[model samples]
Target chain A: MQGIILSNETNALTLAELPKPTLKPGQCLVKLSAAALNRRDYWISVGKYPGIQPEVVLGSDGCGVVVDGPDTWKGKTVLINPNVNWGASEQHQSSDYSVLGMPTQGTLAEYIAVDEDRLMQKPVHLSDEEGAALPLAGLTAFRATFVKAKVTAGKKVLVTGVGGGVSQMAAVMAIAAGAEVYVTSSSEDKLNKARKLGATAGFNYQGAEWVKEAKSVGGFDAIVDSAGGNALNDYLKLIKPGGKIVHYGSTTGKPQELDLFRLFWSQASIIGSTMGSDREFEQMVAFVEEHQIRPAIDGVYALSSGVEAIERMADSSQFGKTVIRMEA
Target chain B: MQGIILSNETNALTLAELPKPTLKPGQCLVKLSAAALNRRDYWISVGKYPGIQPEVVLGSDGCGVVVDGPDTWKGKTVLINPNVNWGASEQHQSSDYSVLGMPTQGTLAEYIAVDEDRLMQKPVHLSDEEGAALPLAGLTAFRATFVKAKVTAGKKVLVTGVGGGVSQMAAVMAIAAGAEVYVTSSSEDKLNKARKLGATAGFNYQGAEWVKEAKSVGGFDAIVDSAGGNALNDYLKLIKPGGKIVHYGSTTGKPQELDLFRLFWSQASIIGSTMGSDREFEQMVAFVEEHQIRPAIDGVYALSSGVEAIERMADSSQFGKTVIRMEA
Candidate 1:
């Protein structure tokens, strides 16, 4: 089996032949067909985020056919949920679950072992690349918007840094949930891509007053701040009274000038969310299936080109999911 | 009618004679029995928090009887739900809406005009003092814990700064919801008070490593942080992967050096929530009524001593809800 390995700090990844993983009792051995890249991956690879262990395979989002598993799961085509609480843990032990590519070995391999419970059946209509793309980014977006922000019909929501996978997913998903989606990106090209994806409005965020441009569409009920630095202060001012500014990333860093006074007085909230729960993931799947929402595929590469996919995430030049194909 | 008015910053509140509020169609005028005070009122009184218009009424929590309204609502005993949007500018605005303080005028007055819809039937057993204390702190805790953090049975939760209004409610409510509640207070006296409210564990947070103290209680599935500052950075380390840290206030100014890297890799969340919605308030009232959760009353002050209540909140020595009594 071949997988991408992060062997040390501040270095490019190495493609290495690795022993195929052995399945634990409740674990499934998956023959992966595709995997997706995320910003977290780039961060982990450089050792900036300390959770990833040396020699760990670094991919959290992947689609595969279950080669061996519980009799109930064998032969099923699925996407690994990637949130594995290694055994020594019970239900939601908080410390037990390690995200793929971080503490635990991830996808980006010929075969990987994962808990059978963390595998969800991939929709037949979705390509392997699409299935791989949907888990980490899709779940993060769903939880950030619907679960954390509780965005609903007619609410004006701003998805910042829309070129990123999660923001794009949130924009598409929020629109499907009946919210009026507005997107901001540094590039006009990506802004147009978001506009074509049913965003009610799109703006190039490089403008001095992009926040004002976003507000002219309508006062935002909530902001999904994928851009978690400077835009956050302005994003705080963009929401209507008692509105929320939900975050899943701190792309900018822990911001200065949190303005606790404004947060308390305006009755506005700064909610932070991560990936969706298994329950929320099911809901997202049902939503997309029911609404027939198509995840945008930027481009697919062979698993050998995982570095290229990661470089795309690093540059923030891609419009949507960048997938690593495992097989035909 | 008489209302407690802040003539200017730090000025002693004077009970001044004023015109009784006249109800608009679909509005109910509340005749005060008792009103509650929050840190918000204290902040508004000092003008440190701004948004305070001079001579404005200074209460956001209270219970009273409806003296004038449509036939259905008149004569009803109700608790006002604080957290209202000003409808005057947003026509087709609700007349029954009330946010006893904040952008809309508040409830510390002898009378407050509110939309009939913002009124909830007072719990049959709660005294005016207790009922008056239930709106802001209670609803804020409700929305932060159950709604935002999604805490449930068997989850380990931390309530930091327990002597304050919201944490008290959070400890009591989290206990009632079957979570393992641990409280943090610099005062041993307050920790004992928290124990009475069903906290499984209590710690004098004075110089203790809260992350270690919380770890002894099985680590937190969620942390309700009203006490922010450098301690929050420590609380950040205490949460399990996928756990939530719901922040409502920072008596400690926003601390620098928040480890965003720990947050992203662990898939942990920091949720910010303020007060609740009309629906959330309704749910809170139902929970209180069903559980018979008695809001703890710290001390009762006469309407003339409204300034003193603000002083008490500033002293940080008092525990539980502070109430201002009107002529019986």
Candidate 2:
């Protein structure tokens, strides 16, 4: 089987021949049709992520055909739930819980053997690449927007870092939920693309007094942010009294200062969400299916061109999910 | 009627004679027996609070006797709910909602005109001073502990800055709810007092590597914190993954930095809560009655000595709620 493997020696991701994965009881072997890249993959390649295992298969999101084990799912098309071993509680993941891409065998390969419970039927409305794109980013957006921020009809929501996969998905989800969705981005092209994807408005955060401009429009009922840094103060300023700031990533690194006076006095909350639970993954897929939403694909690369796809993502040049076509 | 007043001319709280308050329909005239001081009162005295009105009455929590209006009973002892005009949302307060003190004529006076809905029967177990001590701090603690942090039996709860009214009440509430409550305080005396009140253990936060010491005991499932600053990072370190950090006050001021990586990866939440709703106040009162909890009172000052009581609170010298006795 051909897959992209991160080498321990050079710390570079290379297309290499890998042995086929074996399935155990309660596990199904997936013949991956397509896999998607996340920022985590880039971090792992550069040795910045925690628990970096040498020669680990990289990629957390994928859509595939069931090739073996679990007779009921043997021929079904499914999306992999990247998270594994989420413990008993629904409120959060357990200490043992882990995302599939790092220490475990991930989906950026020809085949993956995952727990049978970790597979959901791929939304028939989406293509293999689109289905692959929907797991990690989709789950994260769903939890941040719906579960954490509770975006609803008549609510005004802001999706920050609109060019990223999670932010794009969050905007789409909020829009589908009947929220008036706003977006922020550094690039005009990305902002325009987001507007075309049903955002009510877009702002360039690089602009002078972007926070003031956003505030002039109106306070947001909820803000979905991936970049956590000094900009958090801006979020505190832009959110309405009693509004929520749901953060899933800290791309710009830890926040430098949080005005606690403003936070408590306004009754604003900062909710930290990560990858969704298996239950949330199901709900996310159902939401995508109910809305008939197709994930935006930036580009697809053949398994041989995986390095270029990763590089594009590393540069943050892509506006949507960058995918790898496993069958190619 | 004799009361303490913050003068527009002198910018000082002085004993003054004020006209007796008249009651309107749906309102009752209470002959105030006692009132308590909160940090807000000190802020108001220094003219630092928002919406400071000239010559405003500056007491929020009080216990009084119904002297007029409503035939149900003219002699019932009741504790005033300092929050008023809380519009129809359980999630957050309305724009019109304001604390009873400041702009509104407050309970520092010998008599007060209040809405009938804002009074709860004084707990039979409490004296007027104790009852007065319970309303503001009790409501804030109840909302922060139960509503936001959801501290439950067998849960490990940490109450930060336990010398203050809100934190002390939070520690007591968590303990009453069967949680293993721990406390952090800068003063050893305050920590000892908190332990006497039912905290399982208390840590002197002034000690070197206090975070390390607290972490050695165990990770807390919930932390009720009022001192938000560099200590917030320590709270993050001490809390279990998926724990709640309910913040009500920023006495130490806004946090300088937050490790978003630790926050999100741990799936922790920073929930902002202030004075609770009318419904929450009622619930808090009921909980107090059910648990037979007596609010800790530092000392009672006569109405003529109101300035001294305010001074004591301002200096942060009192270990519990400072009260002003109206009958004196």
Candidate 3:
């Protein structure tokens, strides 16, 4: 099986041939078609992922065909939910929920083993790459906006840094759910794409008063913050009293400085969202099937070029998910 | 009407002669019988409340008989549910919301006028001083445990700084709800009292291995953090995967460093809980009255000694709520 491995050496990626994993009871062998990269993958390469082990497979989101599994789950195209619980009856019900690509060897190889409990059937209409993109980034956005922030219809929402996969997913999903959406990006080109993706308004984050501009749409009912630090603090102030800010990742290294008084005074909440549960992942796949919400595939590369994908993600200038087809 | 005013510019608890307040529609004028002191009242006196007017009355929890008001609220005996609506509604339509002593005139005076919406009917069996002690601190603990943390039967919980009002309430309620409760405090006396309050175990905060002590009881399912600073970070590390730390006050101030990667890896949450909502306050009153959970009162001071009450609250050598009785 072909895969990418991160060594102890910084900023290095190695292409390696690994032996295919054998399946255990309650486990299924997935014939990989496509896998998507997450920001954590890059950080893992640099030892920024806490307590990570070396010489492991480096991708998390993927779509695969169940080549071998429990009879109930065999021979179907599926999306493997990344959160893994090894030694537990249920995936989410376990004591330690490790995501693929972090502590567990992920889905980067041509053949991978995963628990049946965390596998969701992929929609037949979408390509493998699109399905691959939906698990981590899509579910992170889905949970943060809908489940955590409760971005119901008729609410105003802000999705910062709309160029990234999570932010773009947030903008599109919030719009589909009847929320009025706004987007911000440093590049006009990225803002233009956000407008095309149904953002009701778009702004340049580089502007001195983009916060003021975002608030001109009126105080947001919710803000999904993949872009953190001052951007998050500004969103906190821009939200209406009792509104919420759903945070997933802090791409910026800046520490979050929030006024504790403002938090209680407005009855507001700062909710942290990581990834969706197995059940939520299933629900997200169902939504993608019903709404035909395709994962925006900004670029597709072969397995050998995974480093290029990570570099694009680090640049923070990518428009959407970057998927790597596992075939040569 | 005679009221206590502090000599400090914000409180000025010297005796003052003023006309009794006239109530408007949806408003009630309560003749103060007693009020409870929270540590926040001291913050109010030092001109530290974030957005309050000077010479403000400084109490958040009190109980009294309504002297006069619009027909809708006249002649009612009530506990002032001091969580005031900084907005028109509370988080989730419940409506007891406020910055409390920080942003509004409080309940310390001999008489106070309040909107009809913020008062809860006094439970028939409790004294006014007991009822007064049930609002700010009681509701804060209730919501932090029940509403925000969703503590349930069979869960393991850790309540930090036991014997203070919220801490004691959390311990007692956890016991009533069938949870395994652990208490951490600097005082062995307070720790013993917590055991009497039904905590399964109590650990001294000074124990360098309190984290190990917490884990020995099975890593906590949820932690209520009234104790802050590096303590919060240590408590956070003790949370089991997918567990939570419900934070309300940060007595130790900001500057506690956090490892965000640990939070994400363990799926641990730091949820901020202020006081419970208006409806939550009413619900808490019913729960306590039914369960016969009389809040532990350490000492009662005549309203004339409010300054001394504040001093006692700031001293931290005492346990339970300190009440200031105005009538008897």
Candidate 4:
């Protein structure tokens, strides 16, 4: 089997010949047809993610066929939930919970042995690549937008840093849910692309007084943000009283000088979210299917070119999910 | 008529002979029996609060007899709900909502004309001073503990800066609701006072590794905080997965270097809250009546000594509410 591995010595994702994963009890051996890259993969490759085990297969999103174990799922096409051991509570994951990649083996390989519960029937409307893209980023976006921020019809929603996989997915979902969607991106091209995806307007975060511009069009009911820098202060200014700011990532850094006065007086909430529970994964797939959402694909590469696919996440130019096709 | 006034030129709370308030339609002229000092009053006196109006009476909490208004009743004893024009949404106050003080004339007077809807029958078991202390701080604590943090039976709750009016009220409410309460304060005397109020344990925030000590007793299910400084980072480390951190004030200023990683991974929520809605104020009053909970009064002063009452908030030595008795 061929897969991408990140070793302690190299600290980089590399394609290598490796033995196929062995299935444990109640686990299904999935022969992956497609796998997608998330910022999580990029972080692991750069040695920034916690609990990075040396030489672990790296991918949190995949679509494939169950090749062995669990007779009920053996021959079915499936999408992996990626959120392992999500525990019992819907409010949050259990302490033992970990994402698919990291300590446990992941997709982005010939095969992955995942717990039977982590397998869901791939949304029939999606292609293998789109199905792969829908798991990790889709679950994250669903939880951040619906569960956390509670984005809904007639909502004025702002999705920030729209080039990333989760942000793009969140924008798309918010638009499909009848929100008046707005977006921010560093690149004009990405902003334009987001506008074409049904966003009412877009702004460049690098531009002067963008927060002021965002507020001029009536303040937002919810703002989904990934960049956790000083922009949060701006979000506080842009949000209407009682609006929510849901954050799933902090790529830039810590937000300095957070004006808590505005926060408490306005009664705003700053919610922190990550990859969602298995139940949320099912709901996300159902939502994508119901809305006929086809995840935008930036580029797909063969397993041998997996390193380049992960690198595409490093540059801010990519507008959507970067994928690796195991059978290409 | 007499009242405490804040003027631009003086910039100090001064006891002055004031004109008796004239009642308008749907308004009542309440002859106050007691008034309470809150941190909000202290902030406004120091010119820190927004929308400062010169010569406006400076107070929010009051218990009084309806000396004038409506055919319904003229001599009824009542507690005032200081939240004015709270608008429609129960989630947050309307844009036009204002506390009883500041831009609107407040409760720190012998006579106050308040809207009819702001009046509720005083709890039968409470003294005038205790009823006066129950409005602003009681509503705030009810919102932070039951509404926002959702503290419940068998849960472990933490109240930060327990000496403040809201924090003390929140600790009392959480304990009455069967939660195992903990507290943090700079003063050991305040901590001991909190334990007397049914807190299971108390920690001094000024002590070294207080967060570690807090976690050793099992992490908290929710934390009600008024001090919003770097202690937020400590709260993140001390909270259980899915726990909430509800803040009502930011006395110590911005939290430098908030760790976004731990927050998201733990799936915690940081909620900002202020004085609650009128509905919550009603619920709080009901809860206090049902539990026969008496607010702790630090000291009672005559109306002429009202300046000293405001000063008591600045020193942070008082264990509970500092009240001013109108007839003392």
The model with the greatest lDDT is 4
* Cα RMSD, each candidate: 5.5, 2.0, 3.9, 1.5
Model 1 Cα shift for residue A111 (angstroms) = 6.3
DockQ of each: 0.23, 0.70, 0.25, 0.77
Model 2: lDDT equals 0.88
- Please, what are the lDDT tens digits per residue for candidate 2 over residues A191-308? 9999999998999999998888899888999999989999999999999988999889998988778998888878889988988788998999999999998788888889888877
lDDT by residue (tens digit), candidate 4, B104-163: 888888989988999999999999999998999999999999998999999999999999
List TM-score per model, in order.
0.76, 0.95, 0.86, 0.97
- Order candidates by DockQ, high to low: 4, 2, 3, 1
Over B73-155, each residue of candidate 1 has an lDDT whose tens digit, in order, gives 88888898886763443211143444467556678878899888888999987998899989888998998889878889999
What fraction of the real A-B contacts shows up in model 3? 0.10
lDDT of 3 by residue, A95-123 (tens): 56667875667887788888888788888
CA displacement after TM-score superposition, residue B197 of candidate 3 (Å): 1.8
Q: Write the per-residue lDDT of candidate 3 for residues B52-123, one digit (tens) a residue.
A: 455556788888988877675667789887766634445633433454443455677788888888877888
Pitting candidate 1 against candidate 3, the one with the higher lDDT is 1
Per-candidate local distance difference test: 0.79, 0.88, 0.77, 0.89
Instruction: Sort every candidate by TM-score, greatest first.
Output: 4, 2, 3, 1
Model 4 per-residue lDDT tens digits across residues A21-68: 887889899999999998888888787888878788888899999989
Clashing pairs in 4: none
TM accuracy, model 4: 0.97
